[model samples]
Every structure is written in structure tokens, then in C-alpha cells.
Target chain A: MKTLVLVEHGDGKVHDATLATVTAAGKLGSVAALVCGDGEEAAKAAAAAATVAGVDKVLLASGPAYAQMLAENVAALIVPLMDDYDALLCNASSNGKNVAPRVAALLDVMQLSDIISVEGDKTFTRPIYAGNAIATVESSDPKLVITVRGTAFAKAASEGGSAGVENVSGPGDQGLSSFGGCESVKSDRPELTSAKVIVSGGRALKDAETFKEVILPLADKLGAGVGASRAAVDAGYVPNDYQVGQTGKIVAPQVYIAVGISGAIQHLAGMKDSKTIIAINKDEDAPIFQVADIGLVGDLFKIVPELTGKL
Target chain B: MKILVAVKRVIDYNVKPRVKADGTGVDLANVKMSMNPFDEIAVEEAIRLREKGKAAEIVAVSIGPAKAQETLRTALAMGADRAILVETEDEVEPLAVAKILKAIADEEQPGLVLLGKQAISDDSNQTGQMLAALMGRPQGTFANAVEVEGDSVTVKREVDGGLETVKLTLPAVVTTDLRLNEPRYASLPNIMKAKSKPLSAKTPADYGVDTAPRLKTLKVSEPPVRQAGVKVADVDELVAKIKALGIA
Candidate 1:
């Protein structure tokens, strides 16, 4: 079977999640990477993607319309390539979630999303009910389209044998949608998903001011990425990107610190896989403590400053 | 312009779902069911558009068992002019659900189709996009903000690092995210009015769409549990433990 993996990238560099998707694709069959973007940057990304350990070749499809990764245009680009491959795989990232279903629908196939384990070329295991249950699913669709969770697979190494790059023509504009610019949260701290250490806050921080004042110092002291529970994000204490829960990004960092978070099940589903969990809350019986490796019962306003000072 | 909002009934987000012993699926014997939160946001957006005089009618649709009408009633009470329940007892995958919605859209011919980005139950964030593909219409998924104009709609979507905006022609599909307007509670008077509003029922067969599951769920099981560790009395002890572990 031939598998085509979509290489996700930004700022002219391939993302770590794409590497993880490459690893998942390797389990199925011979893997090729599809890098879509505009101009020299797209070629550069294709070069980076070709270095992934398992990729046999790189397909470069560059055009002005591919710049912002619009779903309609991207799906149109992938549809013609479907006949050459048996399965198409992508990281279950934001871009993947946006584009995979369109590709599946255009191909007239069912998509298996957020697969945690690939049992076979046609079977997989995924979480449902917000990770409360794992379901093993088997699909009989002739053409398979799937998105694999990055945390579930190891990142494929970039230092490897050179793979041939093939330049492909754009599928042309679908004329149905157009990209309107992007506003990204500028942060010098590590990215939340790939960060080894993460410091997350909850609604207890009260407002955005208190949240930043208390959380930033601890995160900076530890050189950790900042995260927020749903309550914190809902309260507008931080941007939605900082949210860590079932509905948000999932991470399995080496160390995860929860300050003032009550550990809603949805939030726990996102971070329970962390290697060492720490919870600091005034409430001793908070659900976060149940999953925490080291629990500190105290007021975060007092404990957080002290913790930052010590760090 | 008419607006079509897709709603789904799912297990309440607050309840912890349990895996059955037989590993078929989550045991929903006596669980509280409610409208999916994101769908509520979608419904609210549609209603706001109508209130702003951008839309003429609001039609809410749900695809599920007979009980899903309650979810439709909730949408009706929230301000939908009418409701359509595509009743089905069999398992409906996202693709089939999209196909069913496409058939409904073909008949309704709404200018805008709105839906939640994903249902909390299956977490399959595909229906809206799939429906868009089936109908060959533009889509704006994970929309945090939406602005409707004469011939097009601009949507600010919640993306990976931050926000990305997209512009789609009229008669597009939009899926709501969390940052959309907060849904309003149905007033007592609105609840009584909703009971009298028109509700129509149909089945997947009516659309000639086979509502069979293309994917077979072999088993369902609980995730691995994490055990609780020791409690530290103070920051000093916590720092010591972290130092010992060498993770930080």
C-alpha cells in the first residue's frame, strides 16, 4: 500500500506533528510527504519534510493560493493525488482537522480521525467520550483518509537518507473561498503542545491581570510553556490557544504544574499523560490532586510566588 | 436570507462517561442528555443574525433518535422559527450525517448553514465540512466570529497558534467554536411558544441516504488510570521533589 502524509509547516519549517504523522504513516506502508505552500518557502519545507526517516519521496505543490493553508484549495490539491495512493494521513492538528474531512468527502470516503493506534491498514484505535473510552474501529473504505494524534506517535528523525522531491502543479483556485490574513499570538515561551515543562492556570486567577502576573513568572522561572484550563480560557484570562482540555490541544509534557485548577475531567484528559504531575490549590480535595504526583495544598497567590522565587 | 443550524443531542459535558463491561460503548443508561455546547453556540449565532435583520428565517435540524427532538425544542425555545428532526435509530457516522444534511440543504436552499465544530460525544469534527464538500459549498470551520454581508460572509476562525480569517461567498457552511456568542437561556414564555412551533420529522430514507456505519467499532475500553502520589506540605518540599526527579 502507498501512503501519502500531509506535511504541516509554518514559517518555512516543518512542524513536529508532521514528523509524528510520518512515524504513524510508516506503520502502514511506503510513505511520501506532500508539502503545500507558496514559492521558495514551500520548496524549503518540502526539503525539510523529505529528510524525515520514513518518507520515500516528497511532492511539492506550490502556489500563491496555498500560502495560508485554506481547506478548500488544499483539499482540491489532494483529491487528484488520491488515486495514486491507498491511504492519506495527516496530523490531527488544526489544519488537519480542517482539511481531512473535505478530502474524505471529495473522495467519497469515510475518515478515521484522531486515531491513537493503527491496528492495520484498515483498522485503528481512537478515543471517544473525551478519552473516557477507547474504541477500536475497522473501516472498509477503499480509499482511507486518517488523522493521527501527534502525542500518540514518536516523532520521526529528520537526519536520514535523502528522498527525491517532485514538483507538482497547483490544483488552481476553487474560487469559493479566500484567505483573509492571520493574527497569531506572539510568544517567546515554548509552545504548549511540544513543551517539556508546562505551567497551567485556572479560573482561580480571577482576571487576566492576575493570571499573567502570577502564571508568567512561574512559567518563565521554569522556562515552561503556559497553559490554561477551560475555565481560565472561558473567563478570558488567556487566549483560546492556551486552553488544555478535551476540546483543546492535548499534551504529554515531562512536567505539568496545575495552579488553582480544579482538574475538570476534560482538563485531566488533556494532561493526565504527563510524566510528573503537580497540583497546587487551596482546596485539598480538588480532583487535580487525585492525578497529581505531588500535591501542594495552599493558596496559589502565596504558593505560586514562593515557587517562582525558589525556581 | 434563511439560516440553517445543525444541532446534536449528546451526553451532558459535566457527567463522566463510563465504559460498559461488554466494551460496546459508553453506558448511557440514565445519563443526562443536552444540546452539544458548540451547537448551542451555532444556534445562538443564527438567532443573532436573524435579530440583526440579516436573516429572514431560522430552521434548526437534528439527526438522531426520537429523543433528539428535545434538543430541537431547546433550539426552538432559543429562537429558531421551526425545527426538523431527521429521525434515525441506527448509528450515523459523520459522512452519513453530512449526506443527510446535504439532502436537507438541497430542499431548504438556505443561504447559510451553521453547525458546531464537533459533538462532544464522538468528537468527530467532520459533519459541517463534509456537508460543504458534498454540496460543493465553501466552509468556515471552527469559527469564533462571523460577519454576514450582502453577498459573502467573513469568519474569524480559531486556529493553532491564534486566529485566521476566511471569506466565503454567500450560502456557505460555518461551524462554531467556543468564542462565539454565549447562548441565551430560554425564557418561560419562549418555552411555551417553542411547544407550539412547527416541528417536522423525517428519516434518512427520505433523503435516500444509507445510514449504515461504514466503520465497525470492535471494542470500547477505559483509558489507563493515573495513580495519585504523595502530597507536599510546602514549596520547599515540592522543589526538593522536583530536584530529586530532575525533570525541571
Candidate 2:
């Protein structure tokens, strides 16, 4: 059976995570990387470039609506191709998560999401309770759609082979959902999951008023995305979107810096994947130190300012 | 416009969940059960729709045991007009739950359906989109804000980099995100009145939807334990250690 891997891209470039999903799909069978976008030329180029091992073909579905990623439009485009493949895979990205379920529902199949490891066609492992626990779930259902966690799999080999590209389009009403303009907070730092460095703050910052002063400057210096512990968000020190924990987003930056945060199990689960962890907390025995490669015992109020000044 | 909000009864978000020893699932023998936090956002949005004169009626449904009525009542206390409890003792997978919801949608003919992006327990985050597909309606998943204007609904989705706004026709499914709204707590008076709210209980068989499991939990294991590390004496020591590690 051939696996259909949905390759997502933006601004004429494919996301690197798609390569990771391609690697995971390799375990199943021959792979077909599908790039659906507005410009056939761009899509075809991306498909040709995705030289995943054992890839049979690169399918490109190009249209004006595909220019900007809309879950409904994307789902409509991919649903028709579901019949051509046995298993569907995509990176567990925000876009992938949004569209994969709709596609699964259309085919009346089961979808496994945020999967970390796939042992076989029916068996997979994923994190639960945020990242505090791991569960292995087996799907007995025949049809399957999966969103592979980007960090879970290594990047697939992009050299040594290429696939023929095909341009395909089908009937679509394009009336699934409305497309509203996107408001993005532009940052120079890498995406949280793929970033080599991450700077996180906790309730020790006192409030959001001082976050810009403490975390942002240091994060900017380090070129890292800003993260928050649940305690910080619960205390209204920062927005919930920034919270990192078992209930929040999980990340594995190369370097993770936790400032003024007592590491809770939930928080630790989210960041433990980082290659090197550094924590700054007043409490010497804070749970964060357990996982931290470097632990500083001092008031964040003092340490952060000093660190930022040095940076 | 009639609107339905799907709720799930789960362990309180504040509770540090523990997996059962047998790895069947989360241990819930003594843990206090409450409505999922994101579902609370859905409940609040539905109530706002009703208060704004957008929804003619609002019905909140939960799929779980009879005890889930408590969560439904919480929704009622928050302003849902009625409640439905689809009694299922076992944990219903997202797709199956969506199937049950689609059945209810066919019966209710609601113009809009709202639910949390995912139940905290399973973290599937699939039901809203699945239900939308099953019902042949448009879906706006992970919506941070929804504004209904005449026959069209404007939804603000929480994308990875930022927010994206989309407009969809009526009779769509929308899922709530963290910033959707601050869910208001049920007042004492409303809590008292919620006990009087109309609650209808039915079996999945009644709706001709199978609540059977599609996914099996082969094992549940605790996350690896983090070992304790010593605190460096000062910033200079920390810098020295970090320099020694060659990370920064």
C-alpha cells in the first residue's frame, strides 16, 4: 500500500517538518508527497524537491484558493485523493491538525494525532496529559489518517532520489468555510518546535507588564520563542498561548531557559525534550532544576536583569 | 437560530492526572470530575450568542455516564437552555462522539454548533471538525473568536504564527480556543436554578449510533522522571557551568 503524505508549504517554500513526516511515512510503504497550493509551478517544484525514499510520485493540486492555506479548501482538495492511498500522513502542524480531522471524517476513518512513534500500521505512541505521560494506542479501524508529531521522527533523506510530479484538480464548491485575513506576530526566532533555543518565563516575572523587559530582551538576544509556565499564565502574568506544560504546548528546543519558574511535572514534560536546559529560580529545590543542565539559585528579579544586561 | 454546544466531563484541569496502574486509562477513582475547560469556553460562547439575540435556542449535550449530568447542569447554569446526556460508561472516541453529535444535529437542526477543540482527557481535538464533515457543514476549528453576521459567520482561528480570520455560511461547527473568552462561573442563584433545568438522558442505541470503541489503549506509562540537579552558587558560577557545557 502506498502512503499519501500531505506536504505543506508557505510563501513558496515547504515547511521542513514535512520532511520529518515523510520519514515517518517511509516506515509504512512507498510514499507519495502531495503539495496542494495555488501555483502549479511552485507546488510541482516542491514535490520534485521532496526526494523521500521510496516515493512513487509527487502530486500537485494548484489553484488560487490554495495560495493561502485554508483548512476547508485544503481538506476539499485532499479528500478526493484519499482513494488513491492506503494511509494518510501529515506533520502534526497547526495546519495539519486542522485539516487532517476533516479529511478523516470525510472518509469515515479514524485519525491518530500528535503521534510520537509508529510501530506498525495499527499501533502508535503519543503523549498524553500534555507531555507528562505516554500512551500507546492501537486503531483497529481500517482507514487511517495521522498527524505525525514533527519532532518525533528524524528528517527523511532528501537526496539520492526524485519523483515525477502530477498536477491534479477536482470539482470543489470552495464554499466550505470563510477565509479571514491572518494577523501574525512576526518574530525573528525560529518556530517553537524547531527552534534551537527557547527562553521561557514563569510567574516570577510578577506580571505581563515586566515580561517585555525581562524575557523578550533575553529571548531576542538568544533568538528564541518566548514560553511561559502554566503558573505564570494562571496568575495572569502572560497570555495562555504562551503557557508550556502537559496541558499546554510541548517543545524541544536545543537550549531551553526557564526563568523564575518552579518546574512542575506538567511544565517539565513540555520542555524535557530540549537538548540543554537552564533554569533560574529562587527556590534551590524547584523541580525545574531536576531536568536543567544549569540551575541558578537566585531571585529572578535580580538574575534576569543581570542576564539581560550581559546579553 | 438554534445552536448546540457539545461538552465533555473530564477530570478537573487543575488536578494532576495519574494513569491507572493497569494502563487502561487515567485513574479517576477519587479525582473530582468537572467539565473540560475548553468546553466551558464553548458554553460561554453559546450563551453569548443567545444573549445577543443571535440564537433562538441553545442546547448543550455531554456524552458520558449519568454523572455527566453534572457537567450539563454546569452548562445550563452558564445559560444553555437545555441539556442532553448520552449515557456511555466507556470512554467514547472522538469520531464516535462526533457520530453521536451528528445524530443529534440531524434531530435538532441547529444553525450553529460549538464545542471545545478537544477534551483535555483524550486531547483528540477532532470532534468539532469530524462532526462538521459528518453533517456536511463547514467547520471553523480552533476558533478564538466567532462573530455571526446575518447568514455568514466570521471566525478567527488561532494559527501557529498568528490569527487568521475566515467567514463561513451558517450551520457551521466552531471549536473554542483558550483566548475565545473568559468563561464566567455559575452564580449561586444560577447553580440553584440549574438543578431545575431540563435534562434529557438517552442511550446511544436510541440514536442508532454505536458508542463502541475504535481505538484500543494498549498501554499507559508515566513519563520519565526528571532527576534533581544542584543549584549553582551564583550567576558567575552558572555562566561558568553553562560555558563548560558549551551550550550558550
Candidate 3:
């Protein structure tokens, strides 16, 4: 069975999660990386790097239609490619979450999302109930389209390898629906899924204004993505985009810092995979510390500044 | 334009769910159930669109056991014009549910289809996008806001970093996010009115859709229990302890 992995990129650089997906595809079958963008150099580089991991070749589809970072349009480009491959895989990032299902729907295939393990052709293991439970499911359909939880899988070896790069035309003129517009947020740190360090806030921070001043700078200083607990999001301290929980985004950063957050079960489901967890909460009994590698019992108001200054 | 919103009955979000001691599945025995939060948002958005004169009809649909009629009633009380209960006894995967919705969409011919981004129970986050795909139409997932004009719909979607707005042509699918709108409670009068609202029951067969499992569930296991926590006397002591562990 041949596997097709979708490569996501912005500006010109490929998303690290795509690299992770390539690594995962290696475990399944002969992998082919699909780079859809307007940059030839990046696509060539991506194809070359992916080939080293035993990928047969890299297919590039460059066009202005690929520029908007819209998943609906991207799915239109990918659905046609499904016929040539046995399985389709992508990183379970926001983009993948949006596009993968559409592809599955188009193919009339069943898909598994936020998947952690793939045992064979039909059986897969995934986290359900936010990370509180792991369920093993068997796909009844022959064609499987799945999104791999980026943090659960290991990145493929990129040492001294290159693959053949070929330009291919993806299906366009999907009579695509246009989006109203995009509101962009500036970030200096790496994307949330790729970040090595994460600084997460909880509702204890009082409000959004406080999170911006007290938590964001620390994440910036550490080059980490900012995360928010479910409570913080429910309290309106931050947008739901920043939520990390069973219902929100799952992350496994190298170092996860929980600030002023009382860890709830749903919140813990998303971040339990972090290599090292540091919990800073005034409540010593906060559930977050139960999973923390190191725990600090203190007011975030007093401790965050000290920690950021040190970082 | 007429819109159809699908909802699911799941374990209440506020309650901490526990796996059965027998390892059969989540301990649903005597558990409190509520409308999947996202679907509530979907229902709310549909009702708001109709109230604003953007939509002519707002129909709420649910697929589950007979008890799920309560969920549909809640939607009716909240403002749905009527309800469709696609009654089923067994658990249906998201794909199968989408197939059923596609059948309904074909018959009802709603210009717009809306659903909650993910149901809290399964957390699959698939139904809306999959339904859109099955219908061969454009889709917007994780939408925080939706506005309709003429034959096009503009959706504001929540992305990883921030938000993106997309304009989709009519006969599209859109999913709701937490911030889409604060769902209004069913007032006493509306609750009474919901009893009088038309709720039609249909079997999966009626929609020409099979409710059989497209995915087999092998097993469900509880998450590893969190270890107990330690208490420190003060902030200075906590800082000292954290630093000793090389975490702070």
C-alpha cells in the first residue's frame, strides 16, 4: 500500500508537523509527500528531505489557489489524489483537521482523527474524551484517511537523503467557496504544534488583559506557544483558539509550563504528553501538579515575572 | 433560506466522566446528559439567522435513542421551528451520521447546514465537514460567526493562531465554536410551546441510510490516573522546591 502525506507550509517554510507526518508515513508504506504551494525551492527541498525517509517521490502543485491557507480549497486539490494512493495521512493540526474530513467525505471513506497509533490496515488507537481515555477502533472502509496526533509520533530520519521532485497538477475549479477574510495574529515563536516549550495560562489570571501582560511575554522569552486552560477560555480570558483540553488542541511540547491554572481532567487530556511539565499555581493541591515534573505553589502574579526574568 | 442543525445527546460537560469499572465503556449509568455543547451553538446560530430574517426555516435533527427526543425538544424550546428524530438504538459513527444527514439534506434541501464543531461525547469533530464533503459543497469548520447574504455565506473560523474568514456559496456546511454565541435557555413559555411543536420521527431506513457501524470499536480504556500532589508552606518554599527539581 502506498501512502500520500499532505505537506503544509506558510510563506516558504514547510510546517514541522508535515515532517512528523512524513516520519509516520514511513512506518506504514512507500510514502509520497505532496507539497501544494507557489514556491519551487521549498517544494524541492521538502521533496528531497522526504525522500530520504524512504519516500518514492515528491509531487508539487503550485498555484495562487494554494496561497490562501484555506482547508476547503486544499481539500478540493487533494481529493483527486486519493485515487492514486491507498491511504492518506496528515498532521492533526487545525489545517489537517479541516481538510482531512472533507477529503474523506469526498472519497466516501471513513477517517480517524487525533490518532495516536495505527496497528494495521484497519485497527487504530486514538484518544477520546479529551485524553482521559484511549479507544481502539477498526475502520470498516478500505480506504483510510487519518490525521496523526503530531506529538505522539517520532520524526523520520532526514540524514543524507533526497527524493525525486516532480510538478503535478492538482484538481482545481472546485467551484470553490470563498471565505469572507482572514484576521492574522503576529507570532514570533514557532507554531503551537512545533514549539518545544509551551506556557499555558488558567482562569486565575483574572482576565485577558492580564494574560497578555503576565503570560505572553514569558512564552515569547522562552520561544514557546501560549496555551489556555478550558476555564480560562470559558471565563473569556482568551479566545477558544488558545484552549488546550480534551475538546481543544492536544500538544506535547518538550517543556510545558502551567501558570495559574487549576488543571481539570479535560485540560490535562491535551497536554499530558509533554516531556517535562512545570506547574505554577497558588493552590498546592491543583490537579495540574499531579502530572507536573516540577510543581511551584505560589501566586502567578509574583512568580511569573521572576521566571520570565530568569528565562 | 431554510437551515438544518443536527444535535447529539451526550454526557454533560461539567461532570467528570468515568469509565465503567467493568471496562465496558464510559459509566453512563444514571449519568446526566445534555445537548452536545457545540450543537447547542449550531441550534442557536440557526435560530438567530431565522430571527434576523436570513433564514425561513430552522429544523433541528438528532440521531439516537428515544430519550434523545428531549434534546430535540430543547432545541425546539430554544427556537427551532420543528425537530426530526432519526431514531437509532446503537452507537453510530460520525460517517454514518453524515450519510443520514446527507439524505435529509437532499430531501429538505436546506440552503445551509450547520452543526457543532465537535460533540463532547465522541469528540470526533467530523460530522459537519464530512457532511459537507458528502454533499459535495464548500464547508467552514470551527466557525465563530456566520453571516448570510443572498446566495453566499461568510464564516469566521477559529484557527490555531487566530481567525480566518471565508465566504462560501449557498448550500454549504458550517460548524459552530464555543464563542459562536451564548446559547439562550428555554424559557418556561417556550418549554411549554416546545411540547406543541411538531417533532417527526424517522428511521435510518426512511432516509435510505444504513445506521450500521462503519467503524468497529475494539476497546475503551481509562486514562492513567493522575498522581497525588504535594503541598508546600509558602511561595519561597515552593520556588525552592521547584528549582530543586530543575523545573522553574
Candidate 4:
């Protein structure tokens, strides 16, 4: 079997999620990486990414039409290429979620999202109901399109395989959509989903100003990514991107620190998989303490700063 | 211009779905069913556009059992002009759902299509993009904000990496994200008024779309629960435990 993996890259480097996706795809069959880009930079990134050990070949499409990787044009590029492979793989990133389903629909196949385990040639296990239940599905279709959660699989060894590169031409200028550009931050902090440690805040932080003041110092000291409970996000203490819950980004890092969070079941669905958990809440009965490996009952207003100072 | 919005009857977001002991699927008997929350935002966005004079009509739609008409009525109460229910009993997967919606869009000829990014139940964020693909229209998935002007739409999307924006022609699809807007509740009078609004029904066969599910459910079971670990006495103990776990 041959599996085709979508390659995601930025700043001329491959994303760790793409590497992990390759690892997961390797479990099914030999892998081919499809790197779609709008220019020379995307091509360079593809070349850099193709060296990951498991890839058997790299298919590069760097036409101007791919500028924003618009779901329409990108899915169009992928549909015709599906005839050569048995399965398609992509990280469960927003772009992947946006594109893969279109491909599945056009192929008249059902698309699987955020799959964690490949049970066999056709069966896979995935979480549903905000991680409360796991569902195992088996596809009857001849080909499959799957989006994988990066954290579930280990990254493939990048021991430098010399995979042959193949440039592919696509039907350009689909004219369905145009890119308006991205608003992104090249932050010193790690990306939250892949971060090893996370320090999350809740509504008790009062407001954005206090949230930053209390969460940032401690997070910076531990080099942790910052997260927020749904209540904190709903209270406008942080942007929606900072949300860590069933409706937001699901993370399973090494350590997760919750400050003032009451640990609603939805919040636990997102972070309960973290290897080590810590909680600091004034409410002694807050549900977060039930699963916390290290529970501190106190006021975060004073405790967070003191902990940061000591660290 | 007309805007077509699709809603789904899903298990309420607040409900914790229990897997059946036999492991076939989630037990939905006598469960509280509501319009998918994201679809409420979709209906709300369409109404806001009509209020702004960007849309002259808003048509809400759903595909499920007859009970789904309740979900559509909720959309009507929320301000949609009319609704269509493509009634089906089989479990509809996203691809089939997209096909059914495409058939509706083909007949409605709406300038824009809207839906929730994903239903909380299946959590498969697929229908909007798939409908756009089947119709050969532009798609803006995970939309945070939408602006309609002069036969075109611009959407700010909530992507994994920060935010990105896209501009598309009038005949497009846009999926709602969490931060799109706070959805409005239907007033009592509006609920009664919705009872009178026209809600037409059709079968999947009427649209020439197959309702069979492509994937078979082998089993549905509970995810492994995390066990409670040692609880430290204080911040000092917490820090000490972190050091001992080699997390610091």
C-alpha cells in the first residue's frame, strides 16, 4: 500500500506535526509527501521536509495558484492525484480540516477526522463526544482520507533519507477564492498544542490585564505555553485561540498547570491526557483537584507570583 | 440575494453522551436534542446580514429524521425567513450530507451558504467545505467574521496558526467558528410566530442523493479515564513534585 501525506511547512521548515503524521502513515504503508506551495519558498520548504526518513518520494506543486493554499485549489490539486495512492494523510490542523473533507466528498468517500489509532487496513479509533467516548470505525471505501492528531504519534526519525523529488503540474487559477493574507505572530513562546508544559488560567483571573500579569510571569519562568479555560475565554480574559477545552484545542503535554480553573468535564477532555497535572485554586472543592497530581489550595493572586519567584 | 444556512439536530453540547453497553453507538433515546450551537451562529449571521440589507432572504435547512423539523423551527424562530428539511432516517455521514445540501443549493440558487464548522456530536468538520467543492464554489471554513459587499464576501478564519482572511465571490460557502458572534435566543412571541412560517420537506431520493453511510461503525466505547495522582500539600510541595517528575 502507498499512502500520500500532506506536508505543512512555514519559514522553509517542516512542521513537527507533519513529521508525526508521516510516522502514523508509515504504519499503513510506504509514504509519499505532497508539498503544495505558491512559490520558491514553498518549494525550498518541501525540499527540506522531504529528507524525513520514512518518505519514499516527494511531489512538489509550487504554482502561483497555491499562494494561500485555498481549500478549493488545494483540494482540486489533491483529487486527481488520489488515483495513485490508497490513503491520504494530513495533520488535524485547521488547513487540513478545511481541505481533506473536500477531497473525501469529491471522491465520494467518508472522511475521518483526528484519528488516533490505525486498527487495521480499514479500521481506526477516534475520540468523540469531547473525548468522553472512543469510536472505532471501519471504512468500506476503496480509498481513505484521514486527519491525524499529531500528539498521538511519535515523530518519525529524521535520519536523512534521500527521497527523490518529483515536480507536478496542477490546473491553476481555480478563481473560487483569493487570499487576504494571514495575521500571525512569530512568538518566542512555543505553540500551545505541541508545548511540553502549559500554564492555563481561568475566569478568576478577573480580566485580561490580570490574566497576563499572573499567567505570563510563571509561564515564562517554566517556558510553558499559556492556555485558558472556556470560562476564561468567555469572560474575555483571552482570545479564543488561547482556549483549551473540548471546543478548543486538545493537548496532551508533559505537564499541565491550571490556575483557578474548576475543571469542567469539557476542559478535562482537552487536557486530562497530560502526563502530569497541577492545580492552584482557592476553591478547595474545585473538580480540578480530583485529577491533579499536585494540588495547591490557595489564592493564585499571591501563589502564582511566589511560585514564579521560587522557580 | 438569498443566503442558505444548514443546521443539524445534534445531542446538546451540555449533555454527556453515554456509549451503549453493547458498543454500537451513543445512546440517544430520550436525549435532549438541539440545533448544533455553531449552526445557531450560522442562522444568526444570516439574519444579521439580512438586517444589514446584504441579504433579501434567508433559508434554513436540515437533513435528518422528522424530528429535525424542530431544529429547523428553532432556526425560524431565530429569524430565518423559511426552511427546508430533507428528511432521512439513516445515519448520514458528512459526504452524503454535503450531497443533500448541494441538491438544495442547486434548486435554491442562493448567493451564499453557511453552516456550523462542526457538529459537537460527530465532530466531523466537513459539510461546508464538501458542499462548496460539490457545487464548485469558494469556501471559507472556520470563519471568525464575515463581510458581504457587492457580490463578494470576505471572511476572517480561525486557523491553527493565528488568523487568516480570504475574499470570495458572492456564490460561496462560509462555516461558522466559535468567536463568530454570540448567538441570540428566540423570544416567546418569535417561537409562536415560527410555528406559522413555511417549512417544506423532501426526501433524499427527491434530491437524487444516496443516503447510505460509507463507513461502518465497528464499535463505540468510553475513552480511557485519567486516574488521580498524588496531590501535594502546598506550592512548595507542588514545585518539589514537579522537580521530582523532571518536568521543571
Which candidate ranks first by TM-score, i.e. highest?
A: 1
Backbone clash pairs for candidate 1 read: none
Per-residue lDDT for A1-311 in model 3, tens only?
Answer: 78998877665555667777877777778888887766665565565555556667788877766656566667888878878898899888778888888888888787888788878777888877766677889988878898988788877655445677777776654665764566766767666677788899998899989989999888877777888997898788877778887767788888888998888878888888887788889887777888987787877898888767754
- Ranked candidates, highest TM-score first: 1, 4, 2, 3
Per DockQ, the best of the predicted structures is: 1
Which residue window of length 10 is worst by lDDT in model 4 chain A?
Answer: A156-165
RMSD of each: 0.9, 2.3, 2.3, 1.3
| Proportion of native contacts kept per candidate | 0.83, 0.67, 0.58, 0.81
Top-lDDT structure, candidate number:
1
Every model: iRMSD: 0.9, 2.1, 2.6, 1.3
Can you list each candidate's DockQ? Answer: 0.85, 0.64, 0.59, 0.77
Q: Kindly list the per-residue Cα lDDT of model 2 for residues A142-201, writing each as its tens digit.
A: 777999887778877666567887878855447766566888766666777677778898
Tens digits of per-residue lDDT, candidate 3, B73-122, equal 99999999999999999998888899999999999999999999998777
Name model 3 segments beyond 4 Å from true: A39-52, A234-236, A309-311, B229-248
lDDT agreement with native, every candidate? 0.92, 0.82, 0.82, 0.89
Which ranges in model 2 have alpha carbons more than 4 Å from their true place? A44-49, A52-55, A158-160, A207-209, A230-243, A246-248, A264-266, A284-286, A309-311
Colliding residue pairs in candidate 2: A130-A246, A178-B167, A180-B165, A180-B166
lDDT of 4 by residue, B157-213 (tens): 988777899999879999999888899999999999999999999999999988788
What's model 1's TM-score? 0.99
Looking at model 4 chain B, which ten-residue stretch has the lowest summed lDDT?
Answer: B225-234
Worst 10 residues of 2 chain A by lDDT: A44-53
The runs of at least 3 residues in candidate 4 whose Cα sits more than 4 Å from the true structure, single-residue gaps closed, are none
Q: Give the per-residue lDDT of model 2 (tens digit) for B177-217.
A: 87788899999999999999899998888889877787888
